[model samples]
Every structure is written in structure tokens, then in C-alpha cells.
Target: MLARQLEQFSCIRQARVQLAPQSWQSGAVIVLEPARPEAMPDAAALDRMLDTLALIPDAPDKRHVLVFDTEGRRLYPDHETDETARREQEVALERQALRVLRPLLDGNGRAEVLVSLDEAEKGRTTGRRTISVLLEENAVPETVRPHLESLLGQACALEEGRGDALRICFLPARRNAAALRGLALTFAVLALAGMAAFF
Candidate 1:
């Protein structure tokens, strides 16, 4: 089943998906590139869609990403009244989405949100806007480390060159075995010396 699901996802273009299970409910972010500026989805509509998705039995228990072909069509309704209103609504939806996914993110998983305006938008031609949260392995919520690692790999391919990759570096565990061995040897030598002195 997992293999089939992966095969189904193999054909998606310029799409990124992330999963975090340790966060409040489990979180995810999905971004699609080369999006047309005119087709964004409405914030309220997105919120409702996510809420409905959350209720699904197998709906990414934590978090996941769903990308659209364009920033405008992906996020806002076509009939939106004003640019300012549309922008505000987009921001609100992104914030709520992040909040919903926060609990799902673990120390191993990373959560990121990205937006790319139309190619003709001045100053945004070569740049993309992104927000992310990364947690190191075994830091707090250790159980989600493996899933986060896999998700990070997928995210890297999805958002390649868009920005610096988010990572959670693991700290090496401390080892006292050598010190204990030295201490034991010193105690043994001292005992031998004391026995010799008594002879």
C-alpha cells in the first residue's frame, strides 16, 4: 500500500510535502512552484478545506502539504474584492495552517511554508518567501525522528535551491565507559601495591 501511494505521488511536479507527528496535532506544509498569480484560493475556504481534511481517518494524522498551480489560484477566491483584503486573508490562512500543524512537528521533523508570486511581480522574480521550524533528533519528541528525517529528504527535493535546507543535527551521546575502565585499573594497581608493602 505504501509503495502504491509513493508510485502515485511520483508524477507530481514541483510539489513539496512534510509531516510532523509530535506537534499538537501533527503539521505539514506543501508548496507548488511556477504558480499563476491570478488563481489563489480564499483563506476562509482553505481553512474549511483543511478542517475537513483533518477529519479524514487516514488524513495525514499530523500535517501535510497540498500545493496549487499558482499563488493567486492556490490561496484566494477569484472574486476577492481587493488586493489588500486578499493578502490579509492569505496571511491569516497560512497562520492558521501553521498552528494546526505545530503539534504534529517533532524534534526530528521540520515545518515550512512557502509562497511564490507570479513571475512578473517586481522584486519577487528570483526570490521566494518561506517560513520553517526544525527540531533536532532526540531533542524533545524523540518518537517522530525517523518520520521527520524521511520528510526532510522529500522536502529537500521539493524545494531545491529555493532556500537553505532545514535540518536537525543530532548531538552525540556521552560515553563514560573509558573513564570507568581507567578508574578500575587504578584501583587494582593500588591494591597490588598495598599487598606488596605488607609483605
Candidate 2:
């Protein structure tokens, strides 16, 4: 099944799929190798692989069907292990989520909202991996908060984390979540890439 998907990418020279389940992980897995000795799946190649995996029945779980490079380095599931990589991937997810979810959140832009991403396995009969979207409190005006939350609940395919929605959290913070965590006692805006990219 995966081999056919790999063949579509001209950049891949070799591909391998393994079911090496760890105590922390359960079910199937995908371990990829580079096309050339020095090459790895770029963004386009990655989307090709993940998109195929998405078509499989009962396959919204990204944790099991993950992407890794030739060196056995995680590409898709890179968040928990690498801090810098985590920020990049997590922020990327957050930024994109905000871009899609922002317009839906009315009376926002009073202050910047910092989003954090995490993953978990949920379900009673058949468990599945779910993306956890955590939003700092005050993301929207107090009046709009409930609506924003309800709208996002409808966005995800399943209700794993919300009372029914995928795992969405409203982080309670004393100050701006980004600045508070980025540099304590420092009032600075650590704009990633550009604020425009998110807005």
C-alpha cells in the first residue's frame, strides 16, 4: 500500500515500512528512506505521503502513520523530541490553524493569541491519535470566546478532546502567553515570520 505511494515521488530512491510499535506507540508506522544519500522528503514529498495515508479507511491518526527520514529521524512526529524542531512544527501548525480559525473568531486582534499544539490518543472502542489545539485565554473578546470554541469544535472530524471536539484547550495565563514564556520579565513581541502570515 505504502510502496505505491512512495513510487509517485521521483525524489525517493528507497522506501521501507515497519510496524515497530513501542510501549508509547501502538498500531502501524511508516519509516522512509532518502531518494539519494543526502536527500530527505521535502514539504511537497511529505504532503504526497501523508495525503495517501489519509485516504486509508480509519486513518486520521497521524501518530502511528508517521514520517521519518533515512537516518531514523522523525519528520512528522518531531514535536516532543526536538525543542527547535518542535517550535517550528508546532508554531507552523498554530499559525496555519489561526489563519483558518482567525476570521471565524470575531472581535479578536485585541491582543495576539499564542497557540500550542500537542497530540494524544483517544476513543473508547477504537482509539485514534488526535491533534490538540490549545488556545491562550483572551484569544477572542470575552463575548466571542464561547462562539470561537464552539466553531472549532465543529471543525475537527471527531470529538476526542473537547466535550466532543478534538482536544482543544483554553490556556489560562496571567499575561500574554507568548511573551510570558518566551522571555520572563521582558516585554517584547517575538513575531514569528510575520504577523501578516497568521492574520
Best-matching candidate per TM-score: 2
How far is 186's C-alpha from truth in model 2 (Å)?
Answer: 85
For model 1 the TM-score comes to 0.25
Worst 10 residues of 1 by lDDT: 1-10
TM-score against native, each model: 0.25, 0.33
lDDT of each: 0.42, 0.51
- Runs of candidate 2 with Cα error greater than 4 angstroms are 20-26, 43-48, 57-60, 81-199
Give the TM-score comparing model 2 with the true structure, all chains together: 0.33
Q: Name the best candidate (by lDDT).
A: 2
